[model samples]
Target: MCPCGFLLPIHKGETLPSSLTVRRCDLQRFLKVIRGAGLLSRKGIPAWVSLDASSGVLRLRAANTQVEVQLQLEAADSAFEAIVDAEFLKICSGKEASSVTLSLADDEVTASWFDADVPRAARFVLRSSDSVPPAVAAPEILATNEPHLLEALREAQATTDPGASRFALACVQLRSAEGRIAATDSRQLLVQRGYQFPWAGDRLMQITPVFGAQEIDRSQDVQIGEAGNWIAVQAGPWRIAHAVEVEGRFPNVDLVIPSPSSLVSSMSVETGDARFVLERLDKLPCSDTLHEPVTVELNGSVAIRSRQEESAAAVELVLSRTQRNGNECRLQMDRRYLGRALKLGLREVGFTAGGGPCVARDAQRDYVWMGLGQENTISAADVGDRLLSEESVGG
Candidate 1:
C-alpha cells in the first residue's frame, strides 16, 4: 500500500500515476466554504485534506465526538487518494496563480502554480501521511432551498437561549411533517409555519447552536437527512452532520401565544419607526433587575417610553390603525429582545397587548411574543384606570 493508505503502491521517489488540475478561483471558493464549516485548524498538524482521484473530489474534513463537517470539491482527475495538511493547501490557494496542479508522487503530494506575469514558478511539496479520514455517510432525507431554511432558522435562533435551564430551548426545532419550526427562550417564543418538504413521517430534528445557518452558502439549496442520532445538512459541496442533543421533552411553546380574539388592544406601526425606537432604547442604561423595558401605550396614538434612574426617553409613532373594545392597553418588555424581532424587515409590524403575553407579528406571519417581564408588568385594568384619571382631570 502507498504511504497515504491508497491501495496502489508507488516506488520510492517515483511520481505517482495520478494528477488533478483545478482553476484557482474554484479551489478558493471550495476552501472558503470549508473554512466556514469550522474545520480548518491553525495548528501545524496534518488536518487531513484529501483528494479522491477516481471520484474527482477534493475533501477537507474536521470532526469532534459530536459533530463533523465535510467539504468536497469535484475538480480532481485520475484514480488515487492522498492526504496532506490543511495549512499547505491553504497556502497554495493563496498564491497569485490562475490555476493549481496537484500530483501524487511516492509519499509526497506536490502543488505547483505559475503566475501569468512572473517568470518564476512557485511549488509546495507536502509529505503525505498514512492517516485516512472516515467516510461521511449520506442519509436519506429531504432537500430544500437554502433561503427558506435559513430564514426560518434565523428567526428561531433569535429566540433560542444558549444558557437556558431547559436544553431544548437552546436548539432550533424543525418539524418537517407539521410544516413548522419553533424556538423559544422561555421569555419569548417564535414559530414559523408553511414550509413544504417532500419527506413524510413526523420527524423532529433539533439543531444545536444553529451553526448550519452561518455555515451554509446562501446561494445553494440544502439537502437534509437524519440517521440514528445525527442530522446531516448538505449545502452545495459541503456536508455537515451534528449529533442531536438529548433534550428530553421540549416545552409546549405554542400555548404561550395569545389568540387574535383574546387581544384587548391591537396597534399597527411602520416597521421603520419600531426598529428605530428599539435601537435608540437599547443604548439606555439597564440592570439585571431592570432591563430597559419599552412601554407601548395605546391611546388614540401609540407612544413608546423607556426610563432608567433620572433619565427618560419617549418616541411617538403614528398608528397606521388601531382596534379596541373601549379598553386601553400598556405593555413593557426588554427593548433588546423587541429590537431583534423588529429587525426582520417586515413593512408593517402589528402589536397586541393585554393581560396575556405581548405579541408582535409581521405581514409574513412571523411572530414574536414576550411574556410578562419580572420587573415590568402592568395589567390592562391598571392602564385603563390611569387613562381615566388623566381624562377626568382634563375635563
Candidate 2:
C-alpha cells in the first residue's frame, strides 16, 4: 500500500477498478468531510461515492444533488465506484475495525470490516443505484479573507428564508462588484460588506446552500471558484461545491437602509441586559416565533414586554443605562428577530429611533426589521399604568 500524504481532488470520468481497501482512521476522516459539506440532505437525498487510482492515490468523491466533496487517502488493491444511500458510508465508517474494504459487484456495493485484534469480521451490503450528473468544475480561483467570508455567510443566513417560495429570498446574494453579501426574508434585511471578488465583476450569485459555509476552516485562507451557476469553496483538504440560484435578482438592500439624517435618536444597550430580558420572554408561550410582538422603549427608561395576550406569564423588564436623548419612542417587533441580531456576538446594540423604519446597527453589520404597526404598539404611559396596577393588585 502506498502512503497518502495529502488529499487531492478527483474529477468525473476517471477509470476505476473493482475493489479498494483503506484504514479505519482514513474512512472516519472521509465521513467527517461528508458531514461538514452537508451533502446528506434530510430529504433523503442519495449520495454517490467513487474511487479512482488515476491520481496515484485513492481519490474518493462524495456528492448529492446540491453539494459535492472530494478527498484522497492511501488504499490497497484496485479502485471501485458505487452509488448508495447517503448514510451507507457513515454507518460503514462507524463500525469497530482497524481497516475496511469496499467492493462493487452483482449490482450491489459491499463494505467488509475485520478487527484482527478482536478476531471478528463483519460486512454490510447495499444495492447500487443511479445518481444525478456530476458537479461542474470550478476552475476560476479567487482568494478571500477568512474573517470577511465567514462574517458575510453568517449575517446573510440571519435574513434568508430557506422555506420561501421565491429563490431570491431563500438565498444569500453575492454581489462581487459591490463587495457585499445581502439577504432578505421580506420582513427584514441584513447586509454584510468588506467582500471583494473582482473576478466576478457586476455578476450576482445567489448561494442556496449556506450550511456549507459553517464547515469552512478559519485557520486557512478561503479559496472561491466559479463555473456557470455553481460556486466552489476549498480550504485545506475539504472542498464544497454548491449550486447557485439563477432565477431571480436579490432585492436592493441599500434602498431600505436608513440614512443618518433620517434617524432622529439612537441609543446603545448592553448585550447582557438584552439577553436577560429575552430569557424572561422565552418562558412565555409564543404562537408565532417570527411575528410574536415584543415592545421596547428607549425614552427616559428601558423596558421590554411580550404583547401576546395568550402569554399570561409575560412580564415587563426594565433595564439599566437605557436612557437616551430625552426623546420618548418605542419599537415593537418579533422577539425572535431581535434575538437573531443579538446572537451575532455584539457587545452593544444601537437603535435608530424616529418616524422611520426600525434600524439597528453595530460596528460592521446592520439590522433592519419592520414594525408590527400602530395597532400593536402600547404607549409608554399605558405601560407605566399597567405596571403600577399590577403592583397594587399584588399588594
Evaluate model 2: give its TM-score. 0.75
lDDT of 2 by residue, 1-395 (tens): 11111222322333224666666666566676676556556465545456555434676677765667766555554445555554556655643446555566565555555444332223333434444566458557665666457556656766778677754676777767666677888888887766666365544444444333444466767677776667776666566666676666667788888776656555565655655654555664454566777776666667666644542444566666444543566777677666766666543444455333666776566787766643555555444223321223221
How displaced is residue 247 in candidate 2, in Å?
3.2
RMSD of 2: 8.0
Per-residue CA lDDT of model 1 for 1-395, tens digit only, reads 22222223333334324566666665555456456444565354445466555566666555544457666766654565655655555655643437656676665665555445332223333433435446557777666655566657656766777676645676666666666777877877777776644455443344443343444566766667776667677677667776666544567766777666666666554544554454455664443345556666666556555444323332323333333333466666666666666665533334454434666665345565563432353323323212221122221
lDDT of 1 at 272: 46
Best-matching candidate per TM-score? 2
Off by over 4 Å in 2: 1-19, 23-38, 41-45, 53-59, 72-83, 95-98, 104-108, 114-131, 163-167, 202-216, 284-290, 307-314, 323-326, 347-356, 379-395
Q: Which ten residues in a row have the lowest lDDT in candidate 2?
A: 1-10
